[model samples]
Target: MEQDLPPVLSLDIGGTKLAAGVVTGDGRIHGWQVTPTRREEGPRQVLARLFDLGRKAVADAGEPEVAAVGISCGGPLDTATGVLGCPPHLPGWIDVPVGALAAEAFGVPSALENDATAAALGEFRYGAGRGTRTMLYLTVSTGVGGGSVIGGRLHRGAAGNGGELGHVMVRPGGRRCTCGRHGCLEAYASGTAIAERAREALATGRPSSLAAVGNPTAEDVSRAVESGDGLAREIWDETTWALGTAITDLVNVFEPELVVLGGGVTRSGALLLDPVAVAVARDAMPPAARTARIVLAELGAGVCVVGAGAVAHDLLSGKTPGKTPHA
Candidate 1:
C-alpha cells in the first residue's frame, strides 16, 4: 500500500547547498537536483529558486502530482508553526513562514522539519535504522547536531528542535562553542572544530603535512592522519575522544539500539567509527554498551531530502510526521 502512495516533493536547504528530489514510499529518490545556496541572496530569492528546483525535480521524475511538500533546514525553528527562527547558518532570515509559502506554491500541504531530526527519521525508516526500534543519529558536519528515535517514535523534545545533542558538555571549561558555551561536544568534535584545531597547531610552527595545505579542512586532517602526520593524528584523536565521551553519555542515558553517525566528517569511515566504538564498549555500562551498535549513515548527501519526503508521506497518511504506527 505504501508503494501506491503518491510521490512527495522534498527540499533540503543547507547553508552551502540546496537539494530537491521526488521520493516515493519505497524510500527511493528520483530527479535529485543540487545547487549552491549562495545564501547571501537571502530568503526570498533563495526560496523562489528552491521552489523552481522542486518543480524541475517533479518534471524530471515524471511525477507531476506530488501529494505534499516537505522541507528540511537547520533550525531554532518552530515545527508546529512552520516558522524558521534565526538559524545561525542563515543570518538575516528570521521568522520566515516557509511552510505556508511552500504549500501555496505547490497547492498542497507541507511539513517543515529540523534537518538533523529529519535525517534521523530518514535513516530510521529507510536506511541503516530500518529495523531498529530505538536509534540515535548524530551529524558531525560544519557543526554537530543529532536526533533520536525512541521506542519506534521520533523524539522531538518540548522545544521542538529534537534535543540539542551537540550542546552536551564534554569538558568543563575548554574551547568555546558556537552556542556560546564552553566545552560542548560541538566545540570539540565538529568538522569546523577539527579544521580549526589543525590550523591552530600549524600556527605554532608545528611540522606536519597539514601545514602544506593552503587552508586545511577536516578532510585534510583526516587524510593527513591516514598519511601518518603526527600533528594531524593528535587532532584526530582528540576529535574521536570527544565524540566517544559524549556518545558514552548518550548511551547511558538513552540506551539506543543503534547510534548512526552521518554528515561530511563521518566520511572518515573506520578512522572515526573504530575509536568511538572502542571507547563506548570499554567505558559505558555493560548492559547499555552491549545493546548499542555504532554505524555510519547509508543515505549520505541525500539524507535530508529523503527524510523530508518521509515527513510528507506521514502527513498525507494522517499520521504525525515523526511517529511510527506502533507509537
Candidate 2:
C-alpha cells in the first residue's frame, strides 16, 4: 500500500543549511541535494535557490512526476495558512507564504509543517517510533525543540507549533532562554547552551583542556568529559540534569511509549542518554518511567526530508497530517 503512493518533493529549510529530495512512500530519499542557506541573502533569493534545489532533486531522481510538495522548517508558523511566522532560526523571514510559493513552483498542492513535528511523524511511520502509539521526539541541536505523537496521531497544539517542549522550566530563575523565560530546558541543554557554558567557564581562567582550544563546541565538551576534564564534566552533568528533569515531567504528563532523542548533540551517544535515562527512571512516576523508553533517532540528517515527504503523502491522500491514512 505504501508503494502505491506517488513520490513527493521534500524541502527542509534550516538557518545553516537547505536540503531537498524526492521521497517515495517507503521513506527512501532519491537525488538528495544540500546547500548552505546563506540566509543573509534574504527570503526571496534564498527561496529561489531552494526551489532550484528541489527542481534539481526531482531531475536527479529520474524526473518522476511528484504528486505534491512538502516543506518543513523551524516554526512559530501558521500551518493552515502555510505562512512562516517570526521563526527565531530564520531571522528576517516573517510571514513568508512558503506553501503557496512551493505549490506555484511545483504546480501541485503543498503542505507546510514544523520541522520537529514532521520529524516526529517520520519516526513514527518509518524509524525509531514505528509501532508506537505514543512517542516524544526531542532535538537538542543549536536550540532545543520537540514534537509529540499521541494515540498514533501527531499532536499539534492549539497554536499549531506543537508544544514548545524546550521551554519547560528546569531551574527557576537560572539562565535566560531565547523564549525570554528563565531556566528553560533549552537554556541548559542545547548544543549552543553547552558551548556557551564552556566558554563562560574558560573566560574565568578555569584549568581545562577546553581552554586549549581557540573556541570550544558541544563536541569539545563531550570529548573533554571522555578524557576526564573536571570542568567539562561539570557542564556536561548540568546539561544532562536539565534534560533529564524536563523529560521526567514530560514522561509523567504524556506517558509516551518512546522518547526519541535526535540532533547534533545526541551524537555524543551514551554520554548523553545514559545519565538522562537514569534521572528519568529515578524521578518520574513509576508507571510512567516504566512505560517510557528513551532512544536515539535513526533517520539522522534526512529526517526532515523524509518527514516533509510524509506530509506531502498525507496531502495527496486527503488525510490529516497526524492521522493514520485510511486502509
Whole-model lDDT per candidate: 0.92, 0.92
> Any residue pairs clashing in model 1, and if so which?
none
lDDT of 1 by residue, 221-272 (tens): 9999999999999999999999999999999999999999999999999999
CA lDDT of 64 in candidate 1? 62
- Residue-level lDDT tens digits of model 2 in 91-198: 989899888888888888888999998888898888899899999999999999989999988888999998988999999999999999999999999999999999
Please give the lDDT score at residue 5 for candidate 1.
74
List, in order, the clash count of every candidate structure. 0, 0
Candidate 1 lDDT: 0.92
